[model samples]
Target: MTDPTARPADPIRPTDAEARTLARDLIAHARFAALAVLDPDSGAPMVTRIALVPGPDGVPLTLISTLSAHTSALAADPRCSLLIGEPGEKGDPLTHPRLTLQARAEPADKTALKAHYLSLYPKATLYYDFGDFGLYRFAPLAAHLNGGFGKAYRLTPADLAQ
Candidate 1:
């Protein structure tokens, strides 16, 4: 048994380079993200699962249907956040690293991102050309990376760049 009275060890901060690499990996490998946007009507936070793809520059991008509330909310207000990284089957969920990226979402040029997006999500090809669906690219404004329990770091857009 461990000493109950002993204070837990302070978390060690990763170097800027390490943090940047981790952030890049998370964005690049993310199959999906939990996207949060402000509701246009109530001004309240709303979140939904969204499929993801990384831009050539390693920025996270997604396809959203114009019919969805989150898409409408994004159109009204571009500011949003994406929570990336999912825990594995075993071990404490809190011990898994995750990154919260605060960004501005804007309509992307379909011609520019289509191939890239489809390459990541081959299944999307069926509906990708549909009128209602459009690609949106996120420009990271700031980021908070929680590198497992007691490990965290604040990152700027520059840090996330490839």
Candidate 2:
């Protein structure tokens, strides 16, 4: 006889393997993420949905216009957080297996990185006509993934510091 009540090892604490899997999964499934930029004057969070592209290094890249409020916020303070996942139907959303990334945003240099970003999100090319469309790179400082049903993990840059 075995105890069915026994939990399964409390899931794995984010290993390098887990981190890579989570990052890749988010990249593949998510089309957009809510970018949270801090209001420089009030130091409060302001979130907006922005199309995102994954870079070779797994960092997120986005195209934003200088006219947008979020873009203005980013210009004032580059530190931000992004949230991506399916909204839960019940219970706490945070525990429902979502991905949140603490990141730093910077205007991407018009070089290989920017080119790669554009290639990944070709549809965004249409927005270039806006003139204010500029590439912003969101380099991950840390990440947390809660793959519902008790699968949760945390990752930091040091974990992927290759």
What TM-score, over all chains together, does every model reach?
Answer: 0.90, 0.75
Put down candidate 1 lDDT per residue, 15-98, tens digits, no spaces: 488778888899999989999999999999999999998988898989889999999999899999999999989999999989
Q: List the residue pairs that clash in candidate 1.
A: none
**Whole-model lDDT values for every prediction:** 0.91, 0.74
Global CA lDDT computed for model 2: 0.74
Candidate 2: regions farther than 4 A off: 1-16, 87-97, 110-115, 158-162
- In TM-score terms, candidate 2 sits at 0.75
Clashing pairs in 2: 97-146
The candidate scoring highest on TM-score is 1
The candidate 2 region of ten consecutive residues with least summed lDDT is 109-118
Residue runs of model 1 more than 4 Å from their true location after superposition: 1-15
